[model samples]
Target: MDAFAIQRQLTGIEPLNGSNYTTWRTSVDIMLGFLDYEFVLYEEKPAAITEESSEAVKLLYAKWTKANTIAIRLIRASIGETIRGDIPVFNTAKALQYYYLTQFMSTSYDGSGSVREHIYKICKLVNGLRE
Candidate 1:
């Protein structure tokens, strides 16, 4: 399949910049699903193009890597820095998503930041629990 065909299927989801990891994760996941790009999240094989691989598989792998690269670019700088070492050296896109979900999804509110930030976190915690 042509790459643009798949790219056109993707939603115009905003890049994640750490301001709202929860929403960003959700949006990106939905967008990826819409584009049928979930393999980048689950598969460990097809890491790179191999001489033995067929042309179709090679194209699919290229799409997968492109999706991952786009996602990596969307990540906010600070968030990226925080997770830089934690992200798997190989097969990063899916691993990065998992890292953010595990680290930020269950964060506790310590009332340490600005009032607005604290309120947002408290609301986030409440919303997360409700979900």
Candidate 2:
């Protein structure tokens, strides 16, 4: 594929709801590949650079997705008052991944965490809000 087309396809360059599954999946593939490339870059930099970047990215994703869920829940909390409508994507797993990626991937582009630490830090950002 052409570089321009590939670039457009990878970072999830369009609105989610309007995209076809083929486009979305291809975009996701592109995104993951991009993330992997970033990780490689980090590995090539100063030794600690890779680890720190990885940690930041992973934790950021955890926090971001949880917060996204919280955000939607908050919106739902206002249902019948501030917002009203069946959220078309709420019940799907892919929706959750999209939430995680869209919110956190920019930060997590490097992938340095030990997994456990990322969870604790990011999940903590969700706070105690019920939504």
Question: What 10-residue stretch in candidate 2 is worst by lDDT?
Answer: 38-47
Candidate 2 clashes between residue pairs 3 or more apart in a chain or in different chains: 54-111, 54-112, 54-113, 55-112, 55-113, 57-108
RMSD of 2: 17.5
Every model: Cα RMSD to truth: 7.0, 17.5
Over 76-131, each residue of candidate 1 has an lDDT whose tens digit, in order, gives: 32243543443444355656445445546667667677888766545543432322
lDDT per residue for candidate 2 within 1-131, as digits (tens), equals 56675456433344233213345334444543443332221122223234447877666555445544443443233233211332334632234344444444443424686777565434422221111
- What would the C-alpha RMSD of candidate 1 be, to one decimal place? 7.0
Residue pairs in clash, model 1: none
Highest lDDT scorer: 1
